[model samples]
Target: MKLEDIPRLSLGFLPTPIEKLERLSTDLGISLSVKRDDFTGFGGGGNKVRKLEYLMADAVAQGVKVLITTGGHQSNHARMTAAAARKFGMKPILVLRGNRPDMYQGNLLLDHLFGAEIDFLDPDAYFTEINPRMAHHAAEAEARGEKAYIIPLGGASALGAMGYVNAVKELAEQYAAAGTATPDYIVAPVGSGGTLAGLHVGCAMFMPKTEVIGIAVTGSAVPFSERIAVMANAAAELLDYDRRWTADEIRIENDYIGPGYSIPSEAGNAAIKLAGNKEGVLLDPVYTGKAFAGIMGCVKAGSIAKGSSVLFIHCGGSPALYPFAGLLTSDLKEDQAG
Candidate 1:
């Protein structure tokens, strides 16, 4: 199927600017730029907005009345899915994996403001019973004669991956308009791996010469490259795209996930401060901060060659900084000094 034939909704600001991080570029002795998906301009703005454009469009086509999805307490995907549901005149139901916090803040707070019906599950139950739980909700909604569209965790389905595939096409146009070829590297954080999968397929289709480097920000039971390959290959099959991605083909920098998902790491926090100070870019602890840290590490270790152009795909989770304020304020090196 042609990419244009795929159903998609206009849910985000298109073709986000690619700007050079002048200060950081000079400091690292490389051409460092950022693809600002952060400015997507929807539901607090993030790359998830791109995925939802396809997922929500599918929901509307199927006459879905309730949008259901699962994620961690601070899930940006859940928050944006809820916003998309409301915008499309459908109900939003979030089956979140974690205890309900005393104070709803960050994406959770916005989930409330979007009027999503939130159901919390303990970590153990979340891993083992999430499908059954979501099924139960779907059954209940069906009983009431309403159809529910259950988006996977992080909306990491093939259809959702199409969002980034299209994004890369847009990116190629931007690069062409600027009178240059694709950058040497395209970097982003890998959590549930939707964005990574999308980048794989998108680069294969549009930016064939470009390399995608995904920094793992969360430890998962399955190897991230394997998971990304599954999503990327599925997305490619949808378009009948000749290139098929394998686990070996999916490039993931696995050293940066930290202790686990959502826990702020030392390098990640430092990168957060550096981005803010150097380029006025606000990155969240969970994703982009860790990604930036990987870039810093690569530069320091001479893995990313000097003078090469690198583009950081800023996925944007700044709202998370509020909840991790204490850590964000503390100097990681100073805590060690004390």
Candidate 2:
């Protein structure tokens, strides 16, 4: 099937705006622009909306009424999935890692606002048993005579990643309309790696001149390149693209993953503040913050050459920022302590 032949829901604001990072560009000595996937304008807005457009389309086609998925407590995916499910008149069940916090903040707070039925898994079993937990939810929904559909963590499935494949085509059109060549680098965060996989496949097909760069947000025991290649090849198979990718073909930098998943890093927090102060753009500490820090590191260290035309795919997670307000605003506390 062609990329366009895949089923999709028009759930997000497509062709999200690409804006030049004027201030940051000057600061970094590079021509930088950000593709604002954060402004997709649906289901709380994020890059997940792109994936959910395809994933939810399948659920709608199958007449599924209950959407089951799993993720971290601050998972932008889970929050957006919940919003998508509710908007489509389906019940959303989120099986999240980590115990329920006393105060729901960030994505967890938004998930609650979406009225999603939430289950908290013990951190011990969150990695080993999340799939089964989702399956259990499906079974329960089945027992209640409700049809259920399961979306993998971060909607990382091949069908879901096709959303980014389509996005590449949209991006190509935008650049062509502006009479610009393809960007030298396309940078984004890598959590589940689905978005990065789609980017790789899409770049190979639609924007060969552009290099896809993934900054790891999660510390995985498995190599990101290997996992991303497998997914990219699978997405390519959907379009009969015929190109099989080796792990080495995938470019992912893991230097930015400080501490661990969901834990804010010093560099990430600094990046978050920089982007906010420089661009008035909000980036979550968990994902985009770290990835932006990677971009800063790459540019400063001469990995990405000066004056390179770089595009950062700003996958949205601003909602996750609220949960870290205290950590992020400690400097303010010294002066404003009332």
Candidate 3:
């Protein structure tokens, strides 16, 4: 499918700034920069807007009256999809996996504000398990005479994966315009793997010289790499591009996913503080923070050598910080005194 054929809502602030993190670069002894997709124009901004452009297109094509998707309690994808569904005059239903907390915050709050109907499922409900459940819900909607669209978690479908592939093309142009050497490495957090997969194929087909790295925020490298390979191959097949890349072609670094997914790590927190202090950038705890730590570790370990440029894709989730504000504060008393 040609990218131009996809239906995309005007969601993100396009051509997000690509800035050189000179302070961080100097501190880490490597040339580090950022592709600020965080500024993607909308509610708190996130990478989901990119994927939704295509997914929503399909939804509209199918005459969908409602869009259904699944995610964790504080899923940026669910929040953004809710907002997109509203913008497109469709209702959005979110199936939230994980333990249901008493308090609502972060992306969950945004989901509420957007008026998205949410079903908090059992903690043991995995993504695969939630798939049929979502289908059932969509089917129910259809039975009631409503057309519904079921978007997979992270919008990992071939159409949704095209977003990152298109983003690669955009990044390539950005690199050319910046007049810097092409990125030696491109880094992103691997959750559902769609973003990583898109970047893998996009970089391979467009920016052949660049190496794509996936930092697993959840799961192991073996499965994440395999998922990315599968999605990239599927995406390529959809585009009718007869090209293939091995697991070696796409690198996965697992040093920073400390503890588990959505759980904070010392290195991740330090990396978050460093980016904010040095570059005035905000990275969420779950995705970008861990991915940034991986990039930092790779530089420190000589995996990314000195003088080589590395581009960290800031898949935005700044909203996730609000719910975890308690984690960010050193002292509540200090706040009151101030």
Candidate 4:
């Protein structure tokens, strides 16, 4: 289906800014820009807002009375979905992974503030076996005569992935207006792979010259690449596009993942500090921080050629940093030294 065919709701401050990162770029010896999808205009502003526009539109069009989604403990997707549901006057019920901790922080706090009903699963069962629980929750909701739609992690569905396709198109338009060459590389953190897949196809369709780099914030490069290919094909078919994406079309960097999903890396924390101190940019421990770390690694390794323009898609998870505030703020470089 074409973009026009998808039901969409306005959730973000559209055409998010593509601004030059002169300080960071100069320090790294490259021309770097940022696609500030972080400022997506709701609940601390995140990439999820873009995906939810289409997802919520579909929900509303289907006469959905309640929305359900699954995500990690401090899930940006869950928070954004709750906010969007509130926006449309629909109830949001989030089935988050892991146990509900005593102290609600980050997205969980936002969930409560937004009046979303949240249920947590037993740790062992949740981590190792969440799919069945999520399915069961949907079934229960259906049995209760309430309309419920289950959104996957990170809102990574074909309809949701269309957000990034539209994003690339927006970025290309911004470049054309500014008379700059399309970005040499477009980098983002990958969790469920939809964003990268969408970008893979979007760049191919619109900005063919740009390379899309996915920093694996969770999984390994192998499965991440495979999943991206799978999703890209699905997205292409959804849009009825003639072109198909190959594995080579997607590039993934695994160096920044370091430990595991939601775990912080030293490099990632440092990168977060650098961006905050130098450019006033905020990236959380989960996604954008890891991605920024990868971007820095690319610079240090000369993978991002000197003077070549690179665009880092700030896919937003700033609120999640609340839970890891101590971790993120620790050992930060002294801003005064610079």
Candidate 5:
């Protein structure tokens, strides 16, 4: 089936703005632009909304009443999934990875505000225990006479990746309308690998000349290139496209992850401040900040030549910034004092 035939809900604002980061471009000595997925304008807005549009549409078609998903405590995906479920009059249940914190902040606060039913698991148990049991939880819901649909962490399934496929198409149109050349590189954060996978497939089919780069937010527990290739091929299969991707096609830089997932790093914190000060754009420490730091690192390493055209996909987690206010403020003050 063609991608056009796939089920999708029109939940997010279409064709999110792609703007030039003029000041950042000058500072980096590259032609830099950002695709503002943050402005998707639903449930705090993020790249996940694009994926949820397709995922939730399937839920609606399957006559699901309860939607279940998993993520980290500060998961932007979980919060967005909750909002989309509520928008469609479905109950949302989130199986989160970390234990409940003493205070609700960032996406956790929004998850509660959305009235989602939340359960927590120890970080270690999240992978070995909670993930394996989600299907059982869905079956239990079915036994209760409620239909349940389970979305994997980050909505990383083949169907969800279609959102990014569609995003690349929208971006191509925007670039043409604005009379700009296609970027040489497209950069984004990689967690569950769905967004990057979609971009890989979409770029192969739509913008074959461009290269896609995924900056790892999670540590190297899994080989992201292999995972991304599998997702991309799966998405291509869903669209009835004949193309296949190899793991080598995916280029990932792991240096910026710093400590581990969700833990803020010095380079990421600095990138957050730089984006805010240079272009008046906000980036969350967990994802975009780290990914942007990778972009800067590439520039500094001379891998991305000066004046090379580059596009950064801002996947959006600004709401999560509130939880780290003390860390950010104190660090900035320290930098100034130093």
Candidate 6:
């Protein structure tokens, strides 16, 4: 299956801009740039929009009338999926981990605004229960004479990863058009592994010289690396590509994850403020901020040479910032003081 032959819904603003961060580059003594997937221009603009383009296309192709997905309370994937479903005139059901919050803010608020039917579950039970619960919901919908499509967490399916694979090809074209060198490193956050896996495959095929790094925001590096390989290979097989990715191809730095998923860290908060103040780019505390912190840490540790070119894939989670206002403000105060 050639890429052009694959099913895809024209949902996001394609060929998202790749802009050089002059200020950040000057500060870090490196050539730094960012790929703004955040400007995808749908459902509050996010990287998830890319995956949904393919996932929703498949859903529509199968004559699905409803879409079901699972994720955390503030899941960008869930929020974007709901918005895409609404755009395609399909009902969306989100099986979110965590109890209903006292207040709906950020992506949670947008999920409600998009009219997604949300079913909240205990955080502990979420991992174990969400799959069965989604199946049950689909069964119920079937009984009601409705067709349903269930999307996995973060839309991390073989088809979904095609989004980022396409993104990498787009970035390569952008670089060639702009007469810029291929980045020495391409950095992104690893949540459910699809994006990173896609990047790994895409970079290998399009920008073979560039190294792809993943900042693990949710799990340990070892397991996430394995997961990425699995996802990358699966996506490759779906595309009828003969290449197979290995765990050795995945380089993930787990140090920046801090406390845990969705929990703000001092380093991540500081990185968020730094990007905002220096480059006028907003990064959410959960994913991009931590990944950027890892990038900064690599520069400070001499792991990334001063003159090497680095490109950060800003996956877009700005809405998530609203929920971390208190934590971010406090960290900003300390970051400013020292």
lDDT scores in order: 0.90, 0.92, 0.84, 0.85, 0.92, 0.90
lDDT of 6 at 12: 87
**lDDT of candidate 5 at residue 186, scale 0 to 100:** 97
Candidate 3 per-residue lDDT over residues 1-338, each given as its tens digit: 66665566556788788888888888888788888888897766888888887888778878889899988877889999999999888899999987667888889989999999888888655645687789888998999999998888889877888889888989888878878668888889888989988998788778989888888887743477677788888989888888876666667887788988888788888888888888899998888888999988888798888888889899999888787777766446688999
The list of candidate 6 runs beyond 4 A from truth reads 220-222, 331-338
Error of 5 at 162 (Å): 0.3
Candidate 5: pairs in clash: none
Model 3: worst 10 consecutive residues (lDDT sum): 1-10
Q: What is candidate 1's lDDT per residue for 309-334, written digit by digit as tens? A: 99999988888889998777666668
For each candidate, what TM-score against the reference? 0.96, 0.97, 0.94, 0.94, 0.97, 0.96
Query: TM-score for model 6?
Result: 0.96
Candidate 6 per-residue C-alpha lDDT over 47-133 given as tens digits, one digit per residue, 9 for 90 to 100: 999899888888998889889998887799999999998998999999998999999999999999999999999988877788899
The 10-residue segment with the lowest total lDDT in model 5:
129-138
The TM-score, computed over Cα atoms with residue i paired to residue i, of candidate 3 is: 0.94
Rank by lDDT (best first):
2, 5, 6, 1, 4, 3
Worst 10 residues of 4 by lDDT: 329-338
Better of 3 and 6 by lDDT: 6
On TM-score, who's better, 4 or 6? 6
Model 4, 1-338: lDDT tens digits are: 77767778887998889878999988999888899998888766888887888888889888887788877788888898988888888788888877879899988999999999888876557656667766777788789897878888888888888989888888888889989789888999998888888898789889999988999988743588777888888888999998876776678888889788888888888888899999998888889888999999988898878888899999888888899977765545555455
